[model samples]
Target chain A: MAERVLVKGTEAIGEAAIRAGCRLFFGYPITPQNELPEYMSKRMPEVGGTFLQTESEVATINMVYGAACTGTRVMTSTSSPGFSLMQEGISYMACAQLPAVLVNVVRGGPGLGDIQPSQGDYWQATKGGGHGDYKLIVLAPSTVQEAVDLTVLAFDLADKYRTPVVIIADGVIGQMMEPVTFPEFRNLNTLPKHDDWALTGANGREKHIVVSFDIDPHVLEKMNLEIVEKLRKIEANEKRWEEYKLEDAEIVITAFGTVGRIAKSVVEQARKEGIKAGLFRPITLWPFPYERLEEISKGKKLILDVEMNMGQMLEDVKLAVKDHARIEFYGRMGGVVPTPDEIFEALKKFLNV
Target chain B: MLMGQILSLAGMFEGKHVTWMPSYGPEMRGGTANCTVVVSDEEVASPVTSQAEVIVAMNIPSLLKFEKAVTPGGYLFINQSVVDREPTRIDINIVKVPCNDIADALGNLKVANMVMLGAVVEKTKVVSLDSIFMALEKKLTGGKASLIEVNKEAIKKGMEAAK
Candidate 1:
């Protein structure tokens, strides 16, 4: 049986990471997520784990890279501006195929915009915040409970795919308190073995090197192709989403993260008003869940895309619908949240309820 | 209903849709702030309550900031001891009560929110007291078990005052 307790989002992430067998954490304190490192600092030593409050995000990401290379489960976290600083390291981790978990409790930004919650980084996360042909399996959690749940899932997926995973939550979800149940930490022996590719001194087998290099043009192309194939498989197998009232929805709202939660409440309220509004929330953002959206939009009157950013994910919605359904967008920028009333008004216009 | 964000869960007003869209701005740092909770029987698309039907301002700043945002025929419940304001809007009903003073009498300052919540419920009767109590219990459990009694008492006081 699970016991419920009020948990802050940042602390939940730290606790979940520890329970997931993550032994190393390197992070910098940034607003909206300061509690994560602080929690880790107070708790990691007690569990015989290493928690380092690094000098900067750049240093922190590199520390994650080093720890991950040593075959240790490791993680780090930051907000928007700090996330920007860590991009180069993230890109390197992606290219090197390093499996690590990265948490971005996103705050407003475009250049130190503010320390408030914002989803403006949608494109940055989905389109590879760092660079190159890479993708960070982004999970946008709408609540403190999901924040913990997603952090645990992030480590598992990161290890399985040998890629960095990002848990993108806004300040609202990061700082809020909610009752949540954490699964008991499992024995390390039950987890999948990573000895196949993890660097463990080769253990008298053979010499091993951890690098993202291939001087030969054909070899590099082959490596790139292999990565693409893996991503394609992930897209095919890991597209998880939640559908509410979509089977007969006239106006469907596509949202992720906090906006999705507000959209959900609006759907219920709209239903009482006799408008068939539904919510389609993506659990795995990187995979995009386009196919399911395409299937749901077959007979819908309109698809409303709600986000915290101005219009980052709006493009994806339009692309998925492809003129098959009338599409519109609603959003807030710089950490301002979209209210259910505002969303309801928008839905009424589209559905004519 | 189980999207699991503590602030977005079921409210005291059963059959009413209520959501809290938290301000990610300066108010988040213990500064005076407000959230829009819409208690609607019909479906609501937008959750932002720019102009509230009723507002309970616990501090001077909350009063100053939200005074203009009340609907033309809405009500503004103020703790007279905490906020002193000349009635400027004739269309809106303004009820001034010494809520902070009552909370002081109740032996806790934090019950101010519960008191205001009670007054809002009694004046508007939008949400049921039992439901609010349930939500409050969920919200204030764990390290806060000691204050629940005082908060429950404060809510009772506000309900009686409103009646």
Candidate 2:
């Protein structure tokens, strides 16, 4: 087994990206996620990578688009408001089929609400904040170790599907510290070649053009249809979730990211008190584990949906269960995290035990 | 924040699951800067807890703010040098240690946090002192390397005072 090291979440993500052979990064500074770019700025040079602190988030996302067009592993990270600024570029990336990793260490916000952690951007990330009929593969990680693992996976998925991927983490995951074991560093020389589509001077062959715009409506519709096909395949293959103590669970809890892990404690406490409770945590918010959730929720007495926002993910939970089970929502908005005790209390009240 | 980080590293060295989360933003800027560290045999779930098994209150405001947060029969290490009043909680075990005074005796008041850490470790036995020394060596590197000896001495004094 690899030796474990104590590291902050943001730094762990940066290190994981480097180990995954990502050599280019472009980002703007934002609260909560500032450590990520700061870590990249220091580590990128050491690893012979480029880390550019762009003038703004708009500039940052465009830079990512440009770098990604070269078929290089590239990424940008920001907080909620800055993430909002990158929407137009993200839409363009989605349309152009560019491979890039975008991280949003989300904070409390409709607009710069606070620098504390929040999950208010769930709809924006999984449901496409950017304009257009498109989708970005969204991965939400609960722990620092998972954050590292998913960062590497994000690069792979982005390259595999030739589409942008978003790592939707909260401020708590961005700032927290945990022990993590990193994967072996990838050799840049052995990375998959992308010379087929990459614009590498064309050299006696046809010149490749990458653009999101087209004049004809019919042609654009065809392009949109192709994207839809790709999204369907991704949705079929990429849905990921975790089930804990679900075999005999009378009550099921659905949560993601930071709230998901916290709900695990509630499940443990509930079981200790003779309540048959379980936790179903969605790891992929975009390709939501709707089918598995529907399958597991059967015969469960109550389904509790917990989050750090005003019940954003509850909508998806409702969609998954779909009248099959009783669903309840417990949420705290504007960066207030719900504790395990309160969640257990809520669970006991619902169970009346 | 530093003490919380050290405890996390020590826990890791001891082959336990650990997480360290500090209060950020306004709470860290001249306010009662506090952190939560959870070390467990099983995978840790929440990084933040409403009730904690142990809490080291470094100042009066921190003590007053987190007094009720400690679980019943849990350890609450109070920095008695600065905090003039006694805690109101009766269920929790309170170990009042003069962290600042001990660090002052060790000729470096900045090691006050380390002193409090020693007291906590001595009382709770969460992590070994050797693991703490190892963590300190890793954390206090480069320009801060020279102060490790004084910090270790402060931790020893804190352990003795707790006894």
Candidate 3:
């Protein structure tokens, strides 16, 4: 049974990772996401797990790579800048097909922006910021409980696909406290079946090799094709979103993560004023559920894309809706979140309501 | 922050959806140190709220900053020991409770958050006083339970002084 408790997003993700059988965590401390590593540092030892704080984000992601290759469920947490440092490692892990869960509790960016929340990393997360041709199963959670649930889900998805999964959240989800019930504790004995590829010491069998590099161009192309196929399978099977009051709505608001939650409030406000406004919140940011959005846009009057950055997800929304519907945008940057009232006012002006 | 937890816990105790967003900066007091606790029947979308139905100001600056945000017919709980002036808004209901004085009289000034919490609960009935105590019992960890009695007294004084 899931026990309900008031939880901060960072703490919830940490505890959920532990419950999800994450036995190894290697992460450096960074603002907005420090609680995650701190929680792991305290709790991992209690559960006979390993929690290591490396010297830098580079070291941390590399450590996660090593631990995960050994068939251990490993994770790391960081903010925008720290995540940037780990991007190369992320790409390497993707090519290596290592299953590890990573979290970027996004803060203001471009530089060492403030510790406050911002969704500016949307493009980085969804568009494969690392390098090469690979994708991370990106999940954006709006609520603390969803953070816990998605953190657990991230591990399952990573292990199933033999790829990395990123729980992309913002500072609001990291810093805020809300009542959360964690998913049921998963036993460590029921861990993912990675024995065939895992680099456990060769006992009674041939030594296992976990390598990302291949000299033969055609062989490397085959490996790349395999990873691309996995992404396609994930995309087809794991598209998740939530639709609110879309049945008779004239206008729809599309958003994800923190801005998504605020946009829901705007939808509610618009409805209260007798406007037919609906909300479409994407739970799985990548494997971007464009098909459902296309179906929803069929007869809609307008689709407003509300995001934290000036407009990162705006391009994707436009691509989804195309000329099927007129797409508009409203966003705030640099850790300054747009309020529900502000968003509603913008909606009113945009729709002339 | 303590009061934020208490009220949110009380809301959860009442089966309401509760979310608290706290601000942390360099300065502790007299700075723009405040938090937003959204208690609603529906699933809350955003934790940040520009307008509040209630304002619980523990100090002068909080009152000065949050007073205008209160809705026309909402509630305002002011810690009179710290705030020397009346609210400028005429539309909202104001409950003046000297939380600092109440907690000091009960022997622990730190429980001022609890006192203000009690007044907010009493004035708005946002949660039961029993729920507040229950939340405190679970929260006031080892060695801290010893002070629960004084905090309870402070809450009672807050309830009485709110009107």
Q: What is the TM-score of chain A in candidate 3?
A: 0.98
TM-score of chain A of each: 0.97, 0.98, 0.98
The residue pairs found clashing in candidate 2 are none
Of candidates 3 and 1, the better by lDDT: 3
Q: Against the true structure, what is every candidate's RMSD?
A: 4.6, 1.0, 1.5
Candidate 1 structure quality by residue, lDDT tens digits, B52-99: 888767778878888898899999988776777665778998877678
**Reference-based TM-score of each model:** 0.83, 0.98, 0.97
* Candidate 3 per-residue lDDT over residues A1-353, each given as its tens digit: 55689988999999999999998999898888888999999999999999898999999999988988898899999999999999999999999999999999898878988877899998888899998999898999999998988999999999999999999998899989999988777988898769899998999999998988899999999999999999999999999998988999899999998888888888888999999999988898899999999999988889999988989988889888989998999988888989999999999999886
| C-alpha local distance difference test of each model | 0.78, 0.91, 0.89
Interface CA RMSD, all predictions: 5.0, 0.7, 1.1
Counting only residues 3 or more apart in sequence or on different chains, how many pairs clash (N, Cα, C under 3 Å) in candidate 2? 0
Give the CAPRI class of candidate 1. Answer: acceptable
- Over A234-278, each residue of candidate 2 has an lDDT whose tens digit, in order, gives 999989888989998999999999999999999888888888889
Candidate 2 lDDT over residue span B27-144, tens digit each = 7668789888999999999888999989888988888889999999998889999999999989989999998888888878899998998898899999999999999999999999
Q: How does chain B score by TM in each prediction?
A: 0.85, 0.97, 0.92
Off by over 4 Å in 2: none
RMSD of 2: 1.0
